[model samples]
Target: MKQKSTSPWAWVPTLYFAEGIPYVVVMTVSVIMYKRLGISNADIALYTSWLYLPWVIKFAWSPLVDILKTKRWWIVVMQLLIGAGLGGVALTIPVPDFFQYTLLFFWLLAFSSATHDIAADGFYMLDLDEHKQAYFIGIRSTFYRLAMITGQGLLIILAGFIESSTGLEPVEFSVTTQSTHTEWVVPQAKSVTTGGENQFVVTQADVVIGLNKLNKIQADSIKDWAHKQNLSNGFVIKEVQLEQAPGWWSSNVATPLKESLKERFGKEDKSAMFKGEVQGNIAAFGIRLAQMPEEGENVVLNLDRQSGAKDLSLVEGHRLTFNNQNWDQQAWVLVQADPKLDTAVSADFRGLSGNIPFAWSVTFFVLAILFVVFLIYHRFFLPRPAADKPVAESKNMLNEFVETFVSFFKKENFAIGLLFILVFRLGESQLVKLASPFLLDAREAGGLGLTTGDVGLIYGTIGIIFLTLGGIIGGYLASRNGLKYWIWWMTLAINLPNLTYVYLSYATPESMWIVACSVAVEQFGYGFGFTAYMLYLIYFSEGKSKTAHYAICSGLMALGMMIPGMISGWLQEIVGYQNFFIWVMICTIPGFLIIKFLKIDPTFGIKKQ
Candidate 1:
């Protein structure tokens, strides 16, 4: 079994590297890419996060591949499959309706990735000797880390840069400042631009509300409020051609009361009328600002009383009034007033065209990467493995896969082995896929509604580093102590701290700091507890085909994750966010059951003998 050189075990690094790429691409980067493409954050969360489906359910077909083909065949074939999927993605980039089609393509990519993981893991056992596996433990994790970094970091950075470059936020109105405001208000008045024949501005000045009398209730209240403050009559005016014009602005309705009074009251009578309040009658007409948006910028108020979030800014009976019928809607006089509108939101409120999705080149870039990967794999990689090495010691396909299980099963405890694998990651398989989506969901629906980029930085960067650290620490622990005692307690730690998210669901931490700190706490706890469990899987897979057996364990692990996540979305969707987390906490009953059933040596994680 003595290999030629120190680098004989170089394959482990590649295995882990390949493993990381597709997982990150299909699981993590897809969401990040979709988010920047102008998909609603909520919709991105709901649809894209569901992509965890391939990983979780990958186990069902894993056994078939074991029965029929060499694990090496699975790895190379699936890589070709993935390259095709990515190639398909690239080719469709500029095609009409690409978004809908791309999603299906990525889903295809996910399956290829999941299958590839199974094969690479199996190949690792066939390819490595024990000492090589030992030295290469760090190697596998390191490259896997690289894979995550490559997919989530480099690829996405490229995508973000692409979006920044070729993307269009759109000019929208593309302002024209030449139009006059005066002609708009008076209709026949000479243009504010002074010479233009085009009557570009719209004015509400001519349309009278016809109701000039105030109701007794508002009349009495206004009289009292005005008298209490010792305020005399004055009107606030505003005119707006809010939509359908470029650089369009309507100034407040200006009524020339001073000049009009000289014309109407002939100077002497003007002072008393200007100084006095309108004592005869008053009328009130009002528009209610009823729409309350749940999310986003420049949100138009949907304005239905029953639908939309409630408008908390509303005060009782906000209104407008006419003091007298002698009032001029067109001219400014002591007896007349002009129209006013305080809100100047001007994006074509009459219809649906304003919210057009910005067309971007991110999809085009993603497609390009796909083709590149396919070309590299097709042209250089797939043909190389056969010529470089000979199958000196060949076996039946099933025999190759079953080798590690047969050798280790007799000497190692099978039940104990499964226990270690299950406990090692504990709830990790359930968590990694589920947590991000849950956080990104709406508050009303029980999710934290975090933006996609934030999820990537927090979970992708922070979470991955800690998971690697935990895996390393777990390996050390199993080597030092027996994996037994460390595992039960570690499993406890992993599953228990997760309940923090359960509490976070209802606690309503208003600040981002609170949410981030809480996540870090749970994540770190997950890392600490998971260390011992991972070491046990390696410990159980210690003999001939350990690599192959370990890969099977990995596929099973992915299955565990995929199943919970498949239901996680629907569960969160149904019970809403907080309660779904509460349910996640409740599921710990089964988690505890697994820990209790599997007994490890109490000294397991302390140090290797």
Candidate 2:
């Protein structure tokens, strides 16, 4: 039967778009989500960085993709596998052991996604002729980047919106008051006016007893006496009062007792009589009320009861009695709180108080659904190619695998070439791992203090555009002048913008434009400089087994990224963002030094005139 033909356009964009999603989710989106979910940066970096393992070792199974199934078959199957993995992650996210469980699914996603990449790349070459391959490569690449935007930009912003909506606002303090008896229940149904709105709040406040040093005077003479004693701000007033004998104007009250009396009463009320009978050495007993806030000032009193003894201690229960030597009393300090907090209620459900599992579950499920759609669409539109044999065909699979591994090491300067590829991106790998956290962390934590949405907008959307533009420009420049002339410049390009991160760490700019520009500059340089790295890999892979060698090189590239990224979070947590970025700049030195010794043909990666 003759095969039905399908245009490359019918599936190319979606094909590459599907290719980019799982990779971005496994590598980047997971980092951001874990950070937002309060996973320590160390764990996030360590675990997620390990997800790179699949990509690094993908060459091990590259032959299986060609031998076991058709390229089109592998593509569709991997899509379904990836989709299933995503769904698994979503299901595990809300479970009790979500961190460990979700990571297990992420690993599955990563391996499946890497396999998908291998099959898709092979299928692209097999399906299209030479001219069409060159023509549509950019189209495929553009859609791949668009997938990044969807994952990093739109998806993250959605996560942020859900987070804010479900998250509880911070608590504000109300007022404090002293109760003589420990008999007060927390005063309920209290209201306050805040932000031009009236709200009832549940308030917790601190109360002091015995002697309290005060700023505003409860009585004027007490203020004057406090001033005369060189006591400013406020006077220390005791809970109980001192007594003078009845009709004792002529009786000189002890000067020590005089000070205590004046301090308590602001001056003796000579006309006032002791109402209740006092026992031995007794005067009067009561708690002096602190001058309250102005009427209509929305405030609630939090009463703190304490024993009115020499040692002011918290009251043990709702009631306390005075002994012959002392009286009982309490005092408190006031604090401000949001009036709107009055209406906020704590969630009684299973830890749904702060996190919205439904939101994340829906997001991941939607992503899985999209892949299902992709799987269905491609199954229909993607044409099966006639040439389905492995690029290097052999009857013995083990022999082909051994040959693939051994041939890479047999190449000239293989050690140095491999080393260059492995370390060229060392600084960049660690930098990318920590950049999102630094951008999203609070300013006080030595980060940019940007919201998730802002990070999505600036780094994901704006930065990606510049990165792509830089790559295009870099490709043009390398083609015209060759990789040799631009190699050192490319090294500089890749390494220099790293200082922008250092600058950002130090400046901690709040302005989104400044942040966007900084990220743009850094990403552009990364895109531009990365051209030399890619070309060098292609150049070194030249040989009879070029395809397998190139696959091995890509594996090493992933390894380079994985190792540094694995440690970056721990390093960032230890040294902090500012110093961590400085460390990233320092790591660039090895790459620069390695490039100095690289042997490159002047004509490499250049088209001859």
lDDT of 2 at 463: 84
Q: Could you tell me how far off, in angstroms, the CA of residue 228 lies in candidate 1 after the best superposition? A: 44
- Candidate 1 residues 166-282, lDDT tens each? 312211111111112211121232223323221112222222212133334544564454332212322222223335543322222212433443354332322233222322122
Could you give candidate 2's per-residue lDDT for residues 1-609 as a string of tens digits?
Answer: 898888988999899999999999999999877754546556877799899888878888876675565788889999999999999988988887899989999999999998898788767766764334434544666788889878977887676455445533312222232322222222232233344322222323232221222222222333244233222212122233458665554345534454553455342232134211111110011121122324432121112211121112121111111121221112122211111121211111011112446567767898899999999999988987787555445468777667667777889988789889999988999999988888866555677756544676877678878888877677667766777888899899999999999998888876879889989999999988887787787678665444446667788887889888987885666556777788899999999999878898887655544
Q: Give lDDT for model 1.
A: 0.48
Q: What is the C-alpha RMSD of each candidate to the true structure, in Å?
A: 20.4, 21.1
TM-score of each: 0.49, 0.54
Worst 10 residues of 1 by lDDT: 344-353
Report lDDT per candidate: 0.48, 0.64
Ten contiguous residues with the weakest lDDT in model 2: 275-284
